[model samples]
Target: MSLSLEKILSEIEQLTPEEQLTVMGYLVELVKKHLTQAQPKHKWSDLKGMAPYPLLSEDAQEWVSRTRREADEHRERLLQGEE
Candidate 1:
């Protein structure tokens, strides 16, 4: 590692736990900002037809409704002590 990095690491090591946590939170926010700036921005229209109908071999609304019904039935059975 570079001398500057080593020096910074040494300095960080001397910080109290609370100070270290504060520094860590600052670093995390900096990293998040960098990542957001680096990513390409996309408009909603850009995702159009990305997954056309039947992409999952089922209609989206039907799949959603079917899954909800199945989940409710399972939960009802579990509440009734019927595995």
Candidate 2:
């Protein structure tokens, strides 16, 4: 069926608060599903060595490696605690 702004507004006005909320929630989910489906999927092979990374300074690289090591150590501690 054809939809117009006035008709849609009238229908919305006719519904109780709960029905209106339900309709809005369903509409939001429909929009999200459509958007996700519309996005193009990329294959790893399609990217040559994955996207190129910008040149990083030696200091930045060292900082990143240190931070990663610390994070891994912390994660291991957490897992040991959980056990």
Best by TM-score: 1
TM-score of each: 0.51, 0.49
Off by more than 4 A, model 1: 44-83
lDDT at position 37, candidate 2: 96
Query: Candidate 1, which ten residues in sequence have the lowest lDDT sum?
Result: 47-56
lDDT of 1 by residue, 1-83 (tens): 99999999999999999999999999999999999999998999998989877877998899999999999999999989953
Pairs of residues clashing in candidate 2: none
Clashing pairs in 1: none
**What is the overall TM-score of model 2 with all chains considered together?**
0.49
Candidate 2 lDDT over 11-67, as tens digits, reads 999999999999999999999999999998988788765644543535657888999
Number of backbone-clashing residue pairs for each candidate, in the order shown: 0, 0
lDDT: worst 10-residue window of model 2: 49-58
